[model samples]
Structures are given as structure tokens and as C-alpha cells.
Target: MSEGSTGASVVPATVHLPDDRYIPVRTEDLVAALAREHDAFGELAPRLAHVGEALTRIVSAESGAFSRRIERAYAPFNPDRETVTVGDVGGDRAELAAILAYTFDKANYDLLEDTQVRAAIDSANVHGMKVRVDREKVEELQIFVRGRTQETRLVRTIRRPIVGEMREVELYRRLAVVFRMQNSVEVNIKLFRDIPVADLEALLPHAEAGMSNLDRIKILGGGIGAIGGATWKAAALLVSGTVIAGQYFWALIAGLVGLSVRSVLGYRRAKHLRSSQRTHHLYYQNIANNAGVLDLLVTSIGHEELKETLLAYALLLARGERIDGADALSRAVEAWIARRFHVTLDFDVADALESLDRLGLWADRATMRPLEPEPACARLEQHWRERTTEDYHARTLSQRG
Candidate 1:
């Protein structure tokens, strides 16, 4: 059996590959391995694949990987026969919130089993108390969250439309969005405050719009096509080789081969032009036009999105800082939040820390003080620090010379 990618020493089962090599798969990886095998083999390969999957399921059940009773609980929500694996259902609050949000947003609220539905209700109530959601009108709740997702997409899309002097402005807007997710209202204000007064005014309405980035971009693209309709028609003739006579059928065939390529290029050019014009128009808008842009941007972002985004960033930052054990890291983060955002943060640090371990960001404990960084990550960190120090020395020497 070949060892799994996780590189854990434990070998629960051996899988004989098409090659002579046998892969040693851990108990937790049994179901996954069976799935990979099922996908790799064609229908004519053998019924052995099915038997193997069934055996793996039996082993998983016997080893208490997941209870049959819990699988039954997930059945209603997963009518497509998709298994909502044990690891998926079991996660930290932020992860659970993301899963529940996605499930509800996709209009699957009523289909959720009792456990999942309860979890969703509890999370929405806790994170979004001010927003009222009727059990019957789960879609209404989804609409609110959906708007935030759209706005974020819009914020990211601004990069394509904007360039040059407004690049910093766009960065500020993005940082505002990120900081806002961390519930840092003051930081958002500070970010917006730094932007030019005219630019801020121009950005306000576009940012506040309920339309997503893709939707707005499509609208602009359509407008561009209308204006440049003649150009497109001429290009289509060139691309289609419809102008060529029957005697030159080979030319027509060549045109057909390049048809898709031409269409793609035409679409790209039209999109770029549309984005440029739209951003230019926005750049020239009057400052008086958007009086409440700041408030609009702030209110549009949802609580759950902010928390999830912040948690992800916080975990990444913790890894970079090489923060010590769960307890120490939690205190450091809580203090950082208090200092930076000036807000009281109440969360389950242990669960968050456990999630880091599950993600392979945190190394398993050997002794106290977070142990030494795992060699895999430690080498990279050391290289970066050394490079930074060398750069600093070179810069000082250059200035002195």
C-alpha cells in the first residue's frame, strides 16, 4: 500500500494500485480512497469497485467514523444522495456559519434535517439579531446575505475598471471591506477618509448598488456592443469567412477553426473598453452626488460574512506571526482586536485553535510554548527573514555610499 499525502505514520489499510505498489490509507481516508478508485475505473473495469466502496462504508461505520443515525439526519438536506461527510458537519462556529449560510442561500432551508435547521436558526439568531427572519420566509433572510456577497464581488471587480491614480483608492475600498468584516467601523471610515473627496463621491453610488460586479459588467458590455455594433458585424464576417465563395471552401474551414478564438478576443476587447469608460465616468462624477456613501457601504456588509472573513485572515496572520499555543494565541488575538478595532470579541478560541490543527497550519503539540515551528513551514520563514535582513543592510549601505 502507498502512503497518503498527509504523511501521517499510521497505516489503517493497504490499497493495491494498478501498479504493483500498495498504498497504505488511514482509516479516515478509507472512504476517500474508495471514491477515487470508483472514479478512476470505467464501468467495464470490474464490480470490485462497488464491493470495495461498500466494504469501506462498513468499516467506516464499525470504526464509528459517523453514526448511521446521523447519516439519516442528513438525508433530507441531501436529497441528491450526496453524503454530508462527518468532517463537514463538525467544524468551528465560523465554518459552521459558512456552511449553514451557503445551504440557506441556495434555498435548501426547508429541506434541511432537524439538526442542521436548528444550527442554522441558532447561528442566524446569534450573529444577526437585528435582522428578523421568518421560518417560512428563509429566502427573505437569504436576500439580505446575498446582497453582501454581491457587494463584495463588486468591490473586487472594481480592479478591472480602475487603474492609475485611482489604484490606491481601489485598495482603500478593498481594505475598508476587509476591515468592515472585522467589525472595524472606525478603520472603514479612516480608509474612506484617506481617498480624495471627489473620488469618494464618484465611488459611492456604484458601490451601494444592489447589482453584483458581474451583472454590472454585463450591462456595460452590452452597452459597448450596442455602440460598436458595426465593428462587431465586420469582425464576424472576417471570423466566419461567409464572404468567401464556395470554391474556397478550405478558407471557410480555416475560418471555422479560428471562429471561437476571434469571438473570445472580440469579447475581451469589448469588456476592457466598457470597463475603462465606466470607471472614467465614475471618476468624473460630482462630489455632491453621494451624500451617504460611507453609511451605505457599512450597512450593506453582513455580520456573518465579516466574522468568517476576519477569522480566516486572523488564522493566516497567526501562522505568520508564529504565535504560541492555543491559549497564548487567543489572548494575543483578543488584545489585538481590542487595540485595533476597539471592540469586545467573544468567541470559542479552543475550537478556532482546533480548526487550525485540522487545517495543518498548527503543528501537533510535543512540549509547551507552541513547540518549534514544523520544519516544512520553519524553513520558509527562516529564508524570508534572512532575505529581509540582507535587503535592509544593502539599502543602508547604498544610502551611506
Candidate 2:
């Protein structure tokens, strides 16, 4: 069996399933493995390839419809596109809000929960940059994340600030944030890659880097210390009566002026450091924005749907009799994936079954069985013929008009 990429380790006690729906195995390799394991499927390799192509077409058609809906809803809010002079954006906002959740799910991304958002904001970042977002300014906010992985990252320690130690960190391979400001015309959409969980706040629109308590204490303490030292020196000069009165007054004023300048410079320096950290964090992480994010999401939906359909059909064909119901089929497929590919994932069995049913490949719904390879191929070919015929008629009508 050709091995697939390894996923998160599965422990018997906890039995945690990854939220991501992405399959690590290549489609062709998976088909070949199924054929090798089941001799009945050996001759159906070509048919299986045809099934994949049919499914891809179906997914693409559905994704295109969704893309159109998203585009219409996003037309007014798209930051990259030119502004449209709409009397009221309320309708557009409503449409976008209605479909945003479904769109993210179709794209195989999990919504970041409110609790997770709060945790990210409350926790300190490994990079030591504190960030704050003005929640009142945000009219709408949604964050979607996919492909969670555990990785070791170098984190700066409080004691050893320079040479930080490495620690295990959970990160999202992709993050999409949709933000709309209160009383704003355009909504902002941003896509980022490989974002650390604790640094999610930094990716928020208009997230500002702020001085930490330690930074505040350092600046306040330094200012106080400097003023105290100058005050003591001035008192000594007054008591000794060695310096003239005018000279003493001038020296005290100069000391005060120096202190103010130092304090101002210190604050600016700290502010600059924080701003630089934030800029660097975002520059490396951001991957896409606005209309570009929508394009990527539409493509992801098609790919994920295709993967789900292929896996579900192949499993049903190879082990139809053994699987009794949807739950049983799901478990069977999950076990096979873990055993064959060494990857633990929660197969989206419902969506897979729905696709098969729609394509007329599923035979017994109760048994969760699909049609035999030959019959399945015939059904898929028929679907293609119908789809092409419909397209042709539509094009003819448009041309005639």
C-alpha cells in the first residue's frame, strides 16, 4: 500500500478527530491502491478515473453557482473593486451575512469560536508583541481557520529575552478573517498562512500594538529615577550655597527640560518597536485580500468536494456488504484511512453520501452501498451527457436571442 502523509496522532482514550477535511493522499494513488486490494476493482481503474472527472465537473458547476452568489453579495463590500454608489448597503450586507457561514463550510474551514478569539486576545504572543483591537469599531467579524498542526516554535522567555527556547505550539495553516467596520462602506477580507494560535489578534483589522505592563513600568520607573537624582543634586547645591541663585534656577530648569525630552524619546522608541513588530508579523503572514480571498475559497470548495466524493465512492465499492449504515460506513472509511495512510481524520461522510446519491451511484441507502463499478461508470457517463446537453441548449438559446 502506498503510504499517505501522517496526521495528528490518535490516542485511544481521547479519540480526537481533526477538524480539517483535507485528504493527504493523492487521488490516483488511492484509486490504484483500491484496485490492488480488490481484484474486482482492477479492471475498473479507467472507469474510476471517469467517475472522478464526472464528480469534478459536478463540483465545479456547484462551486461556480456559489461563486456567482458570493460575487453579487460582495460587489459592494469588495475592497479591491471600485465603489458602487448604492443608496443603502443594507441589502448587500444582509446577503453577504447569510451566505458567509455556508461559504466557509464549503471551503472546508472551521469557524473560530468566540472563546478561542478571546483566548487569543488575552494570551501573550510568542513574539512579545502585545496587540489590542477596538471591538466597538467592528460592525461584523468572522474568522475561519483550517489545517491545524502542532509545531515547535522558538518563543522568547521573560528571563532570557534574547536567546528564547523552543516550545510546542498549535498553529492554523490557513486563516481567513472577514471584518466590517461600524459605519464603513467596504468590508475587509484577509487571508493569512501559517498563523500561530496566540497571534490571531494581530491579524484583526486595525489591531494596534500596545505597550505591555512591563514596558510601561520600565518607562515610568526610569523617568522617576532621573527626576529624583536631579532633584537631590539641586538640593545639595542649594544647601552648600556654592552656586549663585540664578545659576541654581537655570540648572534645575535644564534638568527638567532634559527629563521631559528623555521621556518623550523613550515613549516614541517603545512605540516604534511595537509598530515594527506588528508590521513584520503581518508582512510575512498575509497571503491574500478582498476579491482574491473569494477566488481562493471557491477553488477550495471544489477541491474538497471532489476529494470527499472520490473517497466515499471508492470505499463503498470496495466494502459495500460490510458497511451497514452511514455511521458504520464512516467508521469503516476512517479506520481504513488511519490504517492505510497513517492519518487520523474525520471523514465528512454525510456530504460524500449526498454527492453519490445525487450522481445516482448509490444503490442501497440503508446498506450504504454504491453501484458496481460498471454500473457506476454508466451512470456517471449519463450524467456527463445530460450536463453537456443542458449547457449546449443554454448556449444555443443565448446565441439565438
Candidate 3:
């Protein structure tokens, strides 16, 4: 695809957008989705131990600076608050340790702040966060973070015809800010609007990526208050607070907003825990299934070393230790092909993974494996959890608008 040129720097710094077709972001709707994200991680949110252990295991061997940073700086801010949910990870001990993180991208003007975010990335790289991409849109050039999967794609389109990357980051942060309001469909439709010229300068000055961790939560607390004022009042009245039975109905509004906020927070916490439980269940089952598969096909691995690798894969799967092993599994395959095909297979991890990905082995962060349900006779409740809460919320939002 040919890119639009901008004088000396050929990076197509700007993309044309039609004036009339743009959608103004309805702060409420985006807020609702953002709220949903927070609610999804509630009480039983993935424990700090899970991610910490993974980092200690995966990243410790790679970077001394990162290891020191985690111990000295990050560990103090663990978000899970030490809650080891009774059965969040099903029957498997490994899934119990699955690391869950809340990520926020930022651009830092201050060297110290930049260091902090870099430290988080360093930490993630070492400990093993999921494989993620920060790409601009191939289409409208709008931004989005596509996750809830193995491969997370975080798009950071600046949306401004003018302004540098840092400015775009603030806009992105506001985009995240406007996102923290009440759930509404009309709000999502507003994303099509052109980024307002007024809000552009204020939002994009010092933006970067960050972790929405409980420890670092203060970072978001300051911004979440960017929450729309009038709407929050209305919601509080409807959810839990007392509404007037008569008169100006001012009391009614108050009651509803107060009630709604409480109900919303409560519902969100429950929803988050439920989702984590589902994640744990799925990760747990994969471990069990892999182990079972290895048990039956132990000899099929062909060589003892490969057999050991398969066993390690099974263990990591069982443990929910998502260290990317596709690159290595690939090298082994190349050695195998060279022996068989007599064609010298170059050391190309990408191609090996591509071939494996086609055969359902290499995962682009999303598991290529089909989610096979257990046979009815061997089914276990510990192997599953309900995610119906999101459906219910979706329905409520649909009806409300």
C-alpha cells in the first residue's frame, strides 16, 4: 500500500477525514465500557502473585535492571491486595497463578515518569505480559485496544491532523477518560466524530502507557473524575439512592444516581471476578488436556529432548505460564525437516511459526487451539464458569438507550 507523503518525513503523518461524517465521542458510552473493564477485574482480579511469579520465572534471567525495578519499585504496588480466591482458577494449581494486568499507554515529559512507564514495560517484557501490538488503524486510523485474547492489539491513532505523538497520547488519555462514563450505545456511535480542535491541545501533551494496577491506581483516580458530572448525578439516583415520591423530583434524581453508582460498582466487581474465573477455567483445562495428550502420545515426540519440551509445554499450559515458546518449538521442527526433507531449512522462527500457526500450533497471542469442551461423562464443574454477566449488562445497556 502506498503511503501519503509529508515532505521530508515520508511517514504519512496525517490522513484525511471528511468533516460531516465524523462522530463526536459521547463520553458516557466510552465511560461505560471503561467502567466495564474495571468492573471485570474486581475483587477476584488476577492476583499480583500470579504475574509476579511469572516475571520472576520468565524475565529474571533476561534483565538485571528490570528484576531490580520490580523488587524495589513495582512489587510495592501489587494490585490484587493478596486475595487468593477460593476457586477462581478451578482445580488446577497452575491456573491459580495466571497473571492478569491492566495496561495504560502514556507519553512522559518528565524523565522520571518516563522511567516509571519504561520500567513497567521492562517488567512486562521480563515477567511476560501477553504479546501486544501498538498499531495505527489500517482503515479510519481510529484507536482501539483489542484484547481479552492472547494477542492484544492496542491502536494509538492520534486523531489530530496536527500535533506530535505526545499530544496524541493526551487525546488518547481523554479518549480513555471519556470512556469511564456510563454505558450507552449512542456514546459509542459518537466515536465517528472528528476529534474536536479545542480538546486536542489539552489532552495530548504528556501521554504514554501505564499499568492500571491497584498500586498505581492513583494515576487513574485523578483522571476518572473527568467523569461527566450531570450524568453521574442521574445514575446515582436510579441505582441505590432514594428518589422523591413527589414534588420537583430532585430527590428522585438524587436517589437514582446514588443507587446506580453503587449497583454499578457492585455489579462490575462481580462481573470481573466471573470473567477471571472463566479465564482461569479455560487456562486450567488446557493444562489438563495437554497433560492428558502428552500422557497418551509421550512416544510421538520422537526424541527425548523434544519429549521433554512437550512435557514442559504441558506443564506451562497447566501452570498458565504463557511464555512464548513458538520460536523455540520451531527451531526443533526445522532440525526435524532438515533431517527428513534433506532441504536445508534456514533458521526462520517467523516462517516456522507461520506454518505451525496454520496447523494450529503458533498462537498470535490468541490460542490457535480450538476450545474443546470435555466429554459429558468426564465433565467437571471446576473446568467452567459463567460469563453471562456481560450479556446481562449488554442487554441492560441496549434497553436503556
The lDDT for every candidate, in the order shown, is 0.30, 0.71, 0.26
Show model 2 residue runs off by greater than 4 Å: 1-18, 24-47, 83-91, 124-126, 217-225, 388-401
TM-score of each model, in listed order: 0.20, 0.83, 0.20
After superposing candidate 3 on the true structure, give the runs of residues whose Cα lies further than 4 Å from its correct spot: 1-253, 256-297, 300-401
- How well does model 2 score by local distance difference test? 0.71
Q: Encode model 1's per-residue lDDT on 160-248: one tens digit a residue.
A: 33321111111111211111222211111111222221122223211211223444456556545554654455456676766453335
Model 1 lDDT at residue 326? 56
Q: Residue-pair clashes per candidate, as listed?
A: 7, 0, 45
Angstrom error of the Cα, residue 101, model 3: value is 29
Q: What is candidate 3's CA lDDT for residue 322?
A: 36
- What TM-score would you give candidate 3 relative to the actual structure? 0.20
lDDT of 3 by residue, 288-390 (tens): 1212222211221112212222222222233223334655444444443344334332233433233223223222335423111122111212111222121
Off by over 4 Å in 1: 1-329, 347-351, 359-368, 371-401
| Model 3 lowest lDDT segment of ten | 100-109
Clashing residue pairs for model 2 = none
